[model samples]
Each structure stands twice: as structure tokens, then as C-alpha cells.
Target: MSAFSDVELLHDFLTEAGDLLEDVDSKLVELEQSPEDAELLATVFRGFHTIKGGAGFLEATHLVELCHKTENLFDKLRSKKLLLDAEMMDSIMAATGEVHRMFGEMRNGHQPGAAPVELLDALDAAIEGRTVAAAAVVEQVAIQTASEQAHSPVVAEDDLDWAGLYEAVVGVAPRELEQAALSTGMATEAISRQAAAAVRPKAPASKAKAAGPATTTAKENSIRVDTVRFDQILNLSGEIGLTKNRLSCLFQSINAGVVNDDLIKSLDTVVGQLDMLVSDLQSAVMKARMQPVGRVFQKYSRLARDVSRQLGKDVELVIEGAETEVDKSILEELNDPLIHLVRNAVDHGIETIEDRIACGKNPKGIVNLSARQTGDHIVIEIQDDGRGMRPEIIREKAVEKGLISSEEAGQLSVQESLQLIFLPGFSTKDQISDISGRGVGMDVVKTNIQRLNGRIEIQSEPGHGSKITILLPLTLAILPVLMLKLEEQIYSLPLSSVREIIPIEEDRVQFVSGKPTMVVRGEVIPLLDLATLIGRESNPGPKVGVLAVSGDRACILAVDSLVGQDEVMIKPLEGIKPKGVAGATLSGEGLLVLVLELRELIEGKL
Candidate 1:
């Protein structure tokens, strides 16, 4: 039953149980709206029952105990022995969260400690039809924590303060620990840092050497591919094999000195056929790696519900286009960014029920989360019907925060002022809380989206609401780029960044602030020499200007000539990372071309 000794068994259990827990979480949120749905009660009961069975099999005593209590409570509800209430739902959710934490512990090859006594007692009381006020418990625990901390003597470095050391290592202070205890009902036991290390399951030498960080969860390394998609890949492989055999026969005939117009034509036709097969195969493989966005979107309903409850707001998250599919890698990286956006919509974008009613709006605010595919890209939007942003307020806040000057703020257009919220350390809230006020979330959302080769745009109207749109590539394996020549060498820029290609006519170009500039429409755009930016000698008489947007800045990249556009599979250069060089790719003629990281190159230039 040791974790290290049964890695494969534990992995299988984790994969199945993790998905079940997520389903249970979403269902619990739904149950809150339809408290009398007997079928939902039954489904949730079975989910916990199944998890408990698996935990029992794996000898996960803590998990089994926790699930056992939660399952029994659901059983009573389904049998009409007890009615579902807000307090009961809160306790159920807290239990589910504790189960998830236990799963994480198991993922790290540790048998989770006992469930908190307070939470277990709360569940037991609910089963007997007694209401437990979760907030009251949290407040009482907080006071006790403060008192304990106030009375404790200060310790020197050599004094070895076990409680303080545990708090630092686990990122949980005494107040949080007490709160966790009440929420989880974990038995009171001092599990210290050294005690945690002592529980690490011993492993064979080879496994010890090959083991990755304990934090590496099984979900990160696994993907679920539909059988139909896998079959498509297999069929494509067979077609490719047949085409390769035909090409081999054609090559032999040519080698036998039978070169003729007919033979050459046959070779050309086969090569073209082979090209088509390879493309189809590549597409099939990429399809195998695609997953529905609902996999990530399903959990957000629960998230929105939790945030609204904590804030004492009546907010509902409406999801759309959940069936749209995107690359699995993008889905994983997207979760955190989307969480920030959703929380922001509820915490900042949505207004309090009382305020909403006062403004002659619906008492309950609505946050819409949606996703869909457009061409080769995926678009995700988080929209909220709450108090819309005021550009002047945003501008004043930016000025106050020293993110922008008064002069600069005064000149910013309405849309530009709204963009200031994405600036680091810029927030409209006067007070900081566990949510929203620190102003780090939106900045992180922008950075993470950009890292995925994506762009985010914010739009808000006074008295209306705010909508944040995210545009991302369908896949990161192939990058659509704008190819250009720098004398003899060629380079590529992400096509998403390139707005247009214009001729660099001498009459149209002018000098502004001693730097080459051009007027595009009404905006003055700075011109940057591509060769100079990449530390290469500039080619004389560069005639092409690429109108590109890197991050939020627009500039013209001067190049020798435009070579059209292409989609290239990027290949990383091992043991070498040149600044501004994203990756390397091969052109049609087998020439190596560097894919430019435009944002990095133009970061400070504009």
C-alpha cells in the first residue's frame, strides 16, 4: 500500500478520482440552485461512494474517512431524511475541497493526515439535521489563533520555533491553519516539516533516480484522446506507408537509367500525393491532441459561485461554446489566466446587489464566459453586466499610482485609459483584500496570455459592463509567420503580430524626434530596422515596412523585402538561446530561418 511501491496503481486511481471530484464539484454548485433535485443528490452520492471505494482499496485512510462522512450525508439527503440548506451546502463544499487537498497529498506520494475534527464534526451535525454556521466557526477559530500568537514568546533563529517553521514551510499561518482545521475537520496533530519528510515512501534506486518532482501531478502528463481520432491517425499512417512504397519503386526505376518525360511526370504526381498524405497525417495527430474547452470551463461555475458567496453578491456565471476544442497544452496553460479573469469579473466588474438595484439594473449580476474557434485561432471572452469602468477614474488611479503622469493620463483616449488597468501596481480599489485590490491579477493574466502567443483586449463602458477578449492560436506546434528577407538571410515573425506590409517610399517616411517614423492612418508609428534590432548589418535600400503590433505598441519593421507568409514547425536550438530568437525553422528550400520573438525585440524600443 506504500505510495512509492504502487506508483502505477496510484496513478490510475488519481486519474479516475480527479475527474470524478471535478464532476462532483460542478454538481454541488448546480444543487445549490436546485436544492431538491433528487437525481443530483443520487449522482453526487455515488461520486463520493466511488471515490471512497477507491481510497479504501489504496489504503488512503484519511481520504476514505473524509469521503465516508460526506457520502453518508448525501445518502441522507437523497433518502429525504434531511433537507438541503445553504449551510449544509457550504459544509459539503468544504468537505469536497478537503478531499481535493488530500488527493494532492497522495499525488505527492504522501498519505494525507487525518481530516480536521471541526469539519468532520460539522458534517456529523449536518447529518443529524443540525445547522453549522461556517462563518461563525471561521471567526471563532481566527480569534483563538490571534490569542495563541499574541501569548507566544518571540524566538531567535537558534530557538527552533516549530509552529512558525511549519507555517513558513507550508505557506499557512496560524490563522489560516485554524480556518483550514474548521473547514477540513482534520484531527489535531502537529505535522511538522521534518515529520512530512519522514513519511516519504522509500523507493527502489532506479525509481528514485527517475522520479520527477513530487509536485508533478499525473494529470499534467496525461491526455484523453477519442478512439475515433486515434483511428483517423492510424488510417493516415497506412496511407502514408503505401505512398512511401510507391515513391521507392519510382526511385528505383529512375536509378535503372529509365529517365523519361512520362517517368518524371509520374514522380511528380507521386510526390504531390505524398505531400497531401503527410499533411493529412499531421492534422490527424494534432486533432488527437485537441480537447474540448469544457474540460476547463466546467469548473468555473463552481468558482464563480464560491466568489459570489464570499462577497455577498448575487452573481451567476453563464457559459457558452464549451464544446469548442483547442490544443491540450493550451488548455492546461489557460486555466490560471481564465481563473483570474473570471474572479476579476465577479469581484471588480460585478456590483453589489444593493448597488445594482440602485442603478436600476438587475439585482443579480451576470458574467458570461464563452469560447469559439475563428479560422486557426480560438477566442475566449469574459463579459460581465455590472458597473462598467470609468476611463477618467482609471486614468486618475494610474496617475496616483505613478504608473503614468498626469499629462500622459490626460492625453489617453477612453480605450487607452481602460488599458491602464493591465499595468502592474495599478488598481482602482482603495483597500486590499484576499481578492482584487492588489492589482497583480490582471497583469499576470496579460503576461500569461502573451506567453501562449495570444493577445487580450479590454473594453468597458460607463454604466454598461466590461468585456475582455482573448485571441489565441489553435495550436503552438505550427506557427503562422510572415517571412521576410534581410539581404541573403531570411527571418519570420508571428503572423498574428503583423498587421500589414507597406512599401517604404522615401516621400512617405519622415523623421520624428530624430527617429524614422511614418503616419499610419492618424497614429504616428516608429520605424525600426529589423537588421539592426537583430544585431546584423542593415541591407541598403530596404523597401518593405512591416506594420506590426508587439504587445500594445505598434511599429514598422524595416526589412529588405517581403517573402510572403508561411506556417512553419518550430525547432528549438538546444544549448543555445539567442535573445529575440524564438526558435528555428526550415524554409521550403531547406534554408534555416530564425523565428523572431517580436515582443522581446521591441520591448523597450516603442
Candidate 2:
């Protein structure tokens, strides 16, 4: 039904174009920082040119028209026919965003609509020697060369009446300040504070209307793997088949009554070979699912640039250890949580430019996004060199929001207080902005990380900065868990959450605030009975206790006995999923054992 005739060609174009556009975005951001980098400029130009050629081949007129305009703009930029400025860069960024939108439509087998009239006019404006600023708010903060901004001077707040200035530049009455703020994409709070302190005039909106995040989902069905890895998989599969044939022959020989040591030995050798082969095959497949974290990391540079500019803050997102590999499935789910954290670092964690200068810190705040692998887990950190969080302040905010009682707030340690931010509807901000403050950002970050069988830790020092560390298993396909016995049935806790299996000492168990508690090395840990947590009869005199931690909360889980540890593949329950149970796995004896959701159980009990 679509006008595009070649479906396969279109699919290939979308795949390649998506990657090209992402690279272009990163480079464009860099280009703004270093406008004289001819190589970067050429690379960006070629990116658009290649995309335009593909669209032309596919007869996607809308896509081609958009790309051609962008390519020409870059062409002029490279030729020195037009001096690049923040305004032109805004138009370029907007054009790329529109291209991404068009890709979305083509993916659905529909031809994209034409570029907006305003965008074409802006492109035409750039082509000529006039400044044709688009209407509304700027989508990006233009990165200008030193020479371009050198003539601009910082104006003191007392030097000008902001109300008169706003009316003069924006052609609106002072009473319409809020409406004007909306049109310029500045928060009203920012306008009230007269925060547009930059000497340059406010940049106009991009030619295209504000484009939200390119509509993408975490459920990608296709993945790319290296040919070498595929070959390794094939080689292992072939070896496994040969071993299976040998195993079959050995079984036949035994059934034929050849009772020699040679026959028995041969059978054992074949069985060992089959076991090793299967293990190798599994490792090979999991390796195939591994992808570099850079694929996700590369997307955030533009994000940081955009949000920082939107907030009128100077922030730089620095990425490290991007070559670290993670499960492809995990990489997809990580996108949103990472976006939230990065935005938080820019909006909440980083101080305003004035505050940073006043605090004797760098005017341009640095946000570090890094990833690395330790053992079988990936550790990611989002660190900001801005205003660090204060435990006391966090606790106070939590109390004010009614998330915790005054007494509860008083009893929390610094670490626990930091964890309070993860509570739903907890925020420290007095004024709400589009970026943050309804208290949902940190909550989502914690929830998503925990859902991946991971844990998040926060470290902060007021005035220094804040660091949020996340630890996640390498793969969700298999889980290593501690098996426990509860009234003759077995349940498993994720090994990552289990600190140790301690024998419950009756003397060590004490009642604190009318709740059962135990002192382990001077730290008091509350004891939650496993049976009681699941609404079953309480287990009296439970001999074994498992020390488990979820988020920053640690507790002792009383169980009937310890069944040791196992690596298992969990299967979902068919119809009914009971609370506190993550999934079902099989025990060594072929019995169905439930895998407990450690965080859910611990939080529910608390």
C-alpha cells in the first residue's frame, strides 16, 4: 500500500541511516564546540549527503528534501560561504531531529510528510547573509567559537531593569512575562530570576517544532553480531553434533552387551565431551548477545548538550569506558533510566553557572558517564561535579513531603537518608520545572535497575558532587541464586543480594522498637520472617538466617534451612504470579522451586 516499492531497500536504508544520524548528532555537538574542525564538518556533511542519496533512491521525497537542505547548509558551512554561529547550528540540529522523525515513519512503511514551511524558510535564511531566527524557544544552546562570543560582556543584574528589557527585546508587556517565557522555552521561574544572563540575545527556536525524544522503544527484536562469533557458534554446533553421534553409538554398544572396560571408558569419555560441548555452546551464544556500551553512550552527548542549553547551564557530558560490553537486551532497557539520570545530573545535581562560579568551581560543570565490567556484573556510574546532595537536607525534604515521619527521619543514617530520594514523590526542589521535580526521576532509576536484578548506590558530599553507581548482572537469561528451605518447599534469593547465611543465635536476636532484630558486627539488622513476609504462618525458632540487602536496606531473612546455591534459568508462572515471587526455577531433583524477589519482599516487609 506504500509508495516505496523496495521494502528490503527501505529497511537497509533505515538501519544505516539511523546509525549515520546518531553519529551526525554527536559530531554536530562537537562541531559547535570546535567550528573550525574541517574534518568534523566534512564528516557531518557526508553523513547528510549519504542519507539524502539513499532517500532519493527510495523515492522518499520528504526525507530527501530535508536531507538535501541540511547537506547544503553544511556545504556552505564547510566552504566558508557562511560563517557558522549558534543560530545556524540550531537549525542544523533541528533538521537532524526531523530526519529521525522521518525515519520513524519510513519504518512503518509510510512515506514521511514534507519538511515544515518554517524550516525551509530558515534554511533559506541561512543561505542568504541575513539572520533569520526561527520563532519560539531554541532547541539547542549554540556552541560558538571564542571569537564569536568574545565581544559579549556579562551584564550585572543591577545594571538593567529586567522587566523593561524583556518588553523591549520580546515586544511583550511585562504582565505577559509567563507567556513570553513559554514562547522562548524558558521556565517562568528562570524568567522571574532574570536568569538569561548570557550577553547574547536569546536564540530562536529551531525551524521544526520541538521534537521530543525520537520515538524508540527498548524492545528491539533484531541484533547485529560479528561473523567471527557466528563462525564460532557454528563450529561449536558441529562439534556438538559429532559428540551426539558418538554418544548414540556408545549407547548402542552398551545395549549390545559389550561389557569391556574399553566400552565403559568410551561411554564416559563421550559423555564428558558432550557436557563440555554444551557448556561451550552456551557461552558462545551469550557472547553473541554481547554489545559495546558505547552504542548507548554515544546517544547521551546530544542529550546532555540539549538539556544543559535548555536550562541555560553550561554542562559537558564526558564518557569513559564506552567499549565495555553488556548484554544487548540489557542495553535496550538501560536507555530510559540513563536518560533520567543524565537529565537529573544536568537539572538537579549541577548548580547554575553563577552558583558554580561563586563556589569557586569551573563555570562549565562536568558530568561523567562511564561503564565498566567487574567479574560477572557491569558497573555504571553517573557522576556530576556540581552541587552534591546533603543527607540532612534530603531527610528534611523527605519529612516535609510526608514520605517519612520526623522520628523516622531522625533515625536514618546518611546512606539511608540518601536512599530516601528513591522513595516515590520525594523531591528537594521548591519550584517545579519541566525537567524535574515531581519526584519521579530517581524513583524510576531505582525501579528499573532493581527490575534488572541490579542494585544502585549513591555517594555524595555537599558542595563536591554526587555519584550514582549501578551494578547489574551480565545476563538476565541465567541467574545465580541462594536456595533456601521454607516449610519443606524451596525458594531462591538472588546471590548478589545475599551477604551470608548465618546460624540464627537466639541470644543475638533482640526486639528493637517491638520488631525482631539482630546485631551483626555492631550493625543492627531487622529480621523479617520469610513465612510472615509471604502471608504464611510465622516460622518459630528458625535456625538459619540469610543476610540480604536490597537497595540500601539490609535485613535478616529467617528460613527453615539453607539449600546452598545454584545457577538457574527462571521460567515465568503460567497464569498466576504471586507477589514476592520473581519466577520459577527447577531444583536439582527436578522439583519446581520459586525464585523470590528479594527487593519486593524486603520492601514489603519494611
Best by TM-score: 1
lDDT of 1 by residue, 1-606 (tens): 354359899899989998998899888878998988999999999999999999998888888999999999999999999999988887888788778778778888898788778889888999988878766442222112212212111111111232343343334643354333221222112222222232222233454344333223233688999999889999989988998999899899989999999999999999999899899989998998899999889888878888888889988888999999999988977877887888889998899999998999999899999999999899999999988899988998999989999999889998888888889898888999866688786787787788679999988887899999999999988899999987756689999889998889889889987999999998899999987886556767847999998778899999998888999887643222234666666677654466887877776677
All models, RMSD in angstroms: 14.1, 18.1
Instruction: Give all candidates' CA lDDT scores.
Output: 0.78, 0.77
TM-score of 2: 0.81
Tens digits of lDDT, candidate 2, 1-606: 443767877777888888998899899879988998899999999999999998887889988888888888888889988888877877887788778768878888788988777777788788775787653423442222111211111111112233343454344754563344324343333332332332113322331112112222213567899999999999999999999888888888889987799988988888898889888988999999999999888888888887888788999999999999999978877876887888889988899999999999999999999999999999999999988999999989999999999999899898989999899999888888767788877787787788788888999989999999999988987888999887665679989889988888889899988999999999999988887776555657557989999877899999999889899877643222234666656677654466888776766566
- Candidate 1 residue pairs in clash (backbone atoms < 3 Å): 115-185, 115-186, 115-187, 116-185, 116-186, 117-185, 117-186, 119-185
Candidate 2, lDDT over the whole model: 0.77
Assess every candidate by TM-score: 0.83, 0.81
**Distance from true location, Cα of 95 in model 1, Å:** 1.1
TM-score of candidate 1 against the unseen true structure: 0.83
